[model samples]
Target: MINTILPKPFLFLLLILICAETRAVPVPPAAVAYTADIIIYGGTSAAVTAAVRAAKDGKQVIIVSPDRHLGGLSSGGLGFTDTGNKEVIGGLSREFYHRVYMHYQQQDAWMWQKKEEYGNKGQGTPAMDGKERTMWIFEPHVAEQIMEDFIKENKITVYRKEWLNRKNGVVMKKGRILSIRTMSGKIYTGKMFIDATYEGDLMAAARVSYHIGREASAVYGEEWNGIQTGVFQHGHHFKKEVDPYKIPGNPASGLLADISAEKPGINGSGDNKLQAYCFRMCLTNHPDNRIAFPKPDGYDPLNYELLARVFQSGWNELFDKFDDIPNRKTDTNNHGPFSTDYIGMNYDYPEASYAQRKKMIKAHEDYQKGLYYFMITDPRVPANLQNRLKTWGLSKDEFKDNGNWPHQLYIREARRMVSDYVMTENEVLGKKEVPKPIGMGSYSLDSHNTQRYVTDKGFVQNEGDIGVKAPVPYSIGYGAIVPKKSECKNLLVPVCLSSSHIAYGSARMEPVFMILGESAAAAAVLAIDDQVAVQDVSYEKLEQVLLKENQKLRFGK
Candidate 1:
């Protein structure tokens, strides 16, 4: 009772005492310890390339990967490579394809098909001197062997299954990174660091800014950056008035599926979403080397009813894009409507943590597997179409660990860093110029579907897929890989460089990543030698190193 009647000054004093006690507790020190000339975090093509280049340059390098495997999608069932202009590929990137050729030299390498039957047309790059180099298309295990060989040859230190610390453990002294700790309590201190991950995890943890979703086409003055509702290419669009709801177009009947009933965003404006992601499945029609597609658990027929309708609409060009690899296996990809892409379903994946990412991967696996099972086994499926699809199955020689399911899903694009320079469609189309070239990319600007929405004619149609060719190979700016000097001084991001969604489509290829990786490593080495921030490294010096390394900075005549 006496305390309740206390004066205002006394109460204020007690509050201050409590606040002081709370502030007196000290924060715990970061755990773990490691030291290297360069520490690269990721198992992507860029990560591997960076580690190899650094080691070859006589610098101590360590690759900390959360994956058990070495190569990213290159060894992860995406065997049919997405090579734009092969001439731009040099250094470690070219070395990878050469190894693939070496593997195919053995007669036993053609276990499933004869060597001559497979031919050499799509195997590797056509050399500028009119001779053929190693074929780019390869088996998953073959690519893995090549990566393992690179590691052995370089003797690079690798820490597999180690994830970077995204919390307070990325200790920085001044603007440079002092060290980075992982979730397993392992710390790595390096003079220079490359965040080669597709997600830009390490860069984000170091307080570097990044972007997660697609910006509006107008944001970067891009023509193909945002939602494209009416543009349908390759017959992937819905031809019928399929209801977005579970009750089949009756709004009063309530939502039918897991899709949000909210209004689909404006066609050209920005949205907090991304394009679909799926496994570039390595499949085979060979009987002995194929495992008949397994019916996934919790099989849902309703989930694939749209696909059946798509088939019945005479959109049966199912095998149009099964790009062939060696050994009679195919790096199958999205084709007609209701194909493999799980549209508008992977928005949360880029920024998700490890545990959450695994869950998302599993969910995608179930959905895709169930979709295949439904197509083959469901009574509603046309008998002719079912018979045709029955011949296809997962390749036995690939992804054996998870019942022939690929280990990695293709994350087409994610977490592009907002750096000093953002590459736009204008640059790719040759309508604009970018100085300070570090690397080059020439692929067609490609973006898969971002959403499946109803059209004005009341039919479901695929939207946001774009394929626009560039006038020529364009030089990528070095500033795109480095943040402004005020952001972070010592960090380099190769995989997720600064670019709009439309521009990233061309740059996101694996070969380009390898090119950027080498450039980033070269920049890191130069920075270390000059004892200057990465931003301060002269473009002239960087250009010399890139040229010496055989990296193509400009298109050859």
Candidate 2:
């Protein structure tokens, strides 16, 4: 008989080891303190612009950022700027892209490839122009440097790596944020506050009302607010019929790893599901500045079986949208079915604790990195495709600290505040006019795939990816950014504003976020000056300041 019992001493040692493992915990960061007229949370481009605007108005503004770098997605590998109508981009947002144009004007900026060879392609225009004086697309490092310059020039004080203490950080007084404490034990007191974080951490801590996932169409009286299936406008769906089961056409064999066997809800019904998230990879073919995609710790080829099936079906649009940025680099985004979207991976991210969120982020990183490794090495992929993919590698220059990966995940949409004025599809589509115009949004109503499921006919399919173009550039209301007066009177949320799922899908562009950031700062300054709540700030007075600052509140058709 096999010996199964352990010695008494050995069992005691094992119990002790288990206790030590469970008892070990991360120590809280050392304490620090600050006082400012306005405190902005998050290190996004919006956070920087808001701080600058507040400082320009003579308020003592401070930025408490969780990230070490600035400009969130703009500086983070999403180098291909997504401004649908460049004509509507104005103020600091325009200034940012113009600076990108000037950065390329210098010959030394072209490190990996000659500027002439890189050529004129930026959101369908010359990236490096002297006369028209604007560049919509740029390299990641260039954008980060410019944002840092903005902070230095304005003398804005920023404390990096300081996360808001969600449990008991926000101190409320008379329906307003009196102060907030961070995980680092730093206390900040501000008259007016802005939650510029993508997750709306500060806003949630302040007890503000917010929505986490897609709302049913009936709630908003909109056509495109809920789960979308059998609609493949973006061409990311499967091109051919492929079985979702582990063994082709065999229910006994069960479902594939990526394909969910669960029934996707009624087409227009609601569910607690957020859109997919992926790292916008900055990849290059230059031999000197390329690092091969690494095989992560939990590399499972079985996880990517669906992709192998896709290749078997002869779908070859994988490289068609590896968008070129600068040098010989490309911003590798989700292009085809079973690609980088990582469908059904981020449903809990919006509300997950920091620790849980880290696990989700790591899972996404491993999946994406292993995917590239699989493409280059897996035998199931066609030889021609493997040959083409092997030429590209992660850009060594960008995201140098984090294994050449994008520092920020593309958090397309998250916790949106349900304030007094909720931006619905009608306002976004120009069918209903906003009562108070603070900024403009021009991108399409775009939401990435939320779930991958099996069709009744036994084929793999994706749901919740929609790309409906806006009728025209539409205004974003001021009330959308401000919390309901009854909930919290002094908090402003530019990144996670009051909007329906479909409406936020359009307004969540980086340029629009910067515009709203500036506008939110202007309102904060006004509120502080008048000693009133942010919701009580007059729109007429705020518009005067915005117009003076060259904000394009009204956009042309």
Candidate 3:
């Protein structure tokens, strides 16, 4: 017999190495193919609208969503519905809000608070319209219900928790995707594809060119495309002067943990930094349905010492952004200098690995939770403010799985496709005409702070927050949605369509995304019918379909 005896230590070592190697190897499961006329990737509000509209057009559609939840931010947590010119939102987008209005009409919809008790304020318009029967703002769960209704009503197939296999995920032939396999080894084959993800994961994986972070103003020939350090247009920026050093008034003591000591880039220059991200927490003052903010693990009071200093400077505008929605809850957003937007922390998230992204998300959660906890419990915060804040907590009914935190992080902007036509600030601000209008957008060019750093005088300051109003409701071009014909022929990118950073801020609104989603789906249907690449779909035909579908393409047309 062959000698098989080995030292006990050698045998144990061999077993250990084998286990490590086995764990390290990525064993992609055998793929199960699901073919359809159209394949939409993402669980965003845009994804739902795409699937819905495609089905309405008598096309077999499937949504292979990375998220278990369907409606992205609209259902995930952002229920406030950022509507600049609500009139521009038409078609299935408006239909969705109409459904929300219809749902609230039912007596049982008012579970947490009575309908009459709700406020009249919403986007500066009447929140209720018993006549029109359409509600604009709503609770998180209500929005999720609306998205689910669309899927159920249309019988659209959705694969939840199906992540795209980033590496070797997309199989293409002659600049067209043959099929895409998910992380779980499920293959999705479709005639046409729509990338509705916030991150544009599918778009990037298909070998299409995309730009992340800010582009210099020179590239887009616009004023707001790049960095703006001195311009502080929003209230969330630092208004009080506080030293950024660990020791008061001493640079030698070193900067605070999160504060970058390096100089923020020159104004109007391009940089890889992205805007800060945070959860649009659905907090409520309702006693019965409130969970007191728990002290999260790794809570550090020193991290927010600057906020305490701001409070000491007699700043008491904490509740300025506690915009009230229906029920007893508030769509609490980043307001003061040191509010929910975890500044200068998520620059790597646009291209981070999934595991790294999870860590980043968890870090943000812990930071925000700790902020709330400190606000309510710490003595440094004024007693009056403490008492005022104590009444607010995460809604007990929202986000039941993860301690009431929102399921989606506010991924404001990510990888934008370098497509045929890049929408710039000039087009968004109505200085230039959109050649082929598909959808309309009127939201201001709004971008959250990208970084918080020490100024020349060693005082803390925020950079890259802007809110420039538009001259009129501007049109979105079809070229913006379709990738460059040479890059990828069949893919339509709606969420992260071709645009400069500033213009994307206006176009990134949920309603606008849904509108673009439907338009993209309609384009896909047309492409499939005509047997053409997405770029070759005739604008005239696309217009007829969009208008017939009640897509509001322009301001007065």
Candidate 4:
């Protein structure tokens, strides 16, 4: 009867509109509440090792990971491990490499190339050492699978893709964190917390003291803490003078892209600048498993103008860092003066909002992708170099979900905690003996170029690339992982532990992160059992458990 009063066509149209409105409305999922004895808030190698250790110790553990995939950079792209002294690596860290070794033993693991055909290349050691029973180098997918195997064997609970609400997520009472909430409205309550993220988001939100940029050399009585304008230890600086202006030798025209007009800061002085960040691309030349480098959206040639000039200067070191991995793949990294390191573009990433950081990450991806595309397509590149680059492409068998691009960017340095005893160059250089030894680091004190600015001589140059090798294996103290007693008592920060920028450079390796992660979990278990703050845990008790768990705390102990 109602349809008879109105036009049939109008009635039908109104019904359609009503149905569309109804479909547009979304129903939100209910908030989840989880309680655990220990809650780890990251998806890095440290997070997985921490969760495994906690679960092994008979403690209920939960991993609230922002990442959909496990193993941060270890599984992301850096399959070529950076093991300083393999003897110093112990506990779950060594177990990971052992697993890699076991996997490579199967003939199926050698898909692209035969096991004997792949040479044993590594960082001052064999890639697959039979005597040691460890394989330091591997593929991205293999590493992820091992991490998955770890959690599965340990029966650890993990909630992936849950980002921490940095603003009002961390709830603290009486100098201890009670619980934390994620962006998905899920609440996680724990007696002890571990901030294993490279960004240190939970640690920062909990009102813990931290440092973003380099500290002055005088601040901690160290020589390599701050800016280094002229020192070039890694040969990444421009060997030849490259003009910085749009029109060569003419200062009147604007400066070329990627060449800053600012003066290189005074050496040994402090600034808010941070080390460069880029993706560790996994590439291969096998035609069957290669996807040509994509021309990302908003491709621009000007971004790599400086690199072209470097090529023109007879600098053909672009392939210097294409370190080989299994299956004939490469773990490509920043090499030349103007390579993949997006210099000076990540200074604000340490404290940026989530949305802003994603934009920055996307910008880095675009810049790097454009660099590869430019190398292959640009006329400025040498014909021979371009031809050789054409042989290589992104590994089709790797990172298949995101078009063969790595999901995690290499965040070399970020917010580092500032606890009571900060590790400095002195501690890393073996000048001072550590008090409560928890782990060991023997890598070089390495920091990539922080900025690219014009020198007073009117040539573009890179600054902040310092590489100082440690004299011997140095011990990392327990105080470096826990926060101050007054700030937060129950939180342990392993990946972003208390260290100077120079000290962190040596200790930030993936193997070292796992060592600290396992040690931190042992301490957390002890603290929870004693019903005390993490800082109050007895070092003797922690050392006993670490040694029992096969964690190499001291050099020869």
User: Looking at model 1, which ten-residue stretch has the lowest summed lDDT?
Assistant: 123-132
Pairs of colliding residues, candidate 3: none
For residue 141, model 4's alpha carbon misses the true position, in angstroms, by 0.3
The digit string of per-residue lDDT tens for model 3 on 169-286 reads 8999999998999988899999999999999999999989999889998997999879998898877777777778889888899887688877898889999888889999999999
lDDT of each: 0.81, 0.90, 0.90, 0.94
Write down the TM-score for model 1: 0.91
List the candidate 1 regions with Cα displacement exceeding 4 Å. 1-32, 119-130, 239-249, 254-260
Pull out the clashing pairs in model 1. Answer: 123-135, 123-136, 124-134, 124-135, 124-136, 236-337, 246-256
Better of 2 and 4 by TM-score: 4
TM-score of 4: 0.95
Give the TM-scores of the predictions, in the order they appear: 0.91, 0.94, 0.95, 0.95
- Residue 46's C-alpha lDDT in candidate 3? 96
Tens-digit lDDT string for candidate 1 (145-177): 888888889998899889887867688877788
Model 2 Cα shift for residue 477 (angstroms): 0.8
TM-score of 2: 0.94
In order, how many clashes per candidate? 7, 0, 0, 0
List where candidate 4 sits over 4 angstroms from the true fold. Answer: 1-30
**Quality of model 4 by C-alpha lDDT:** 0.94
Model 4: clashing residue pairs?
none
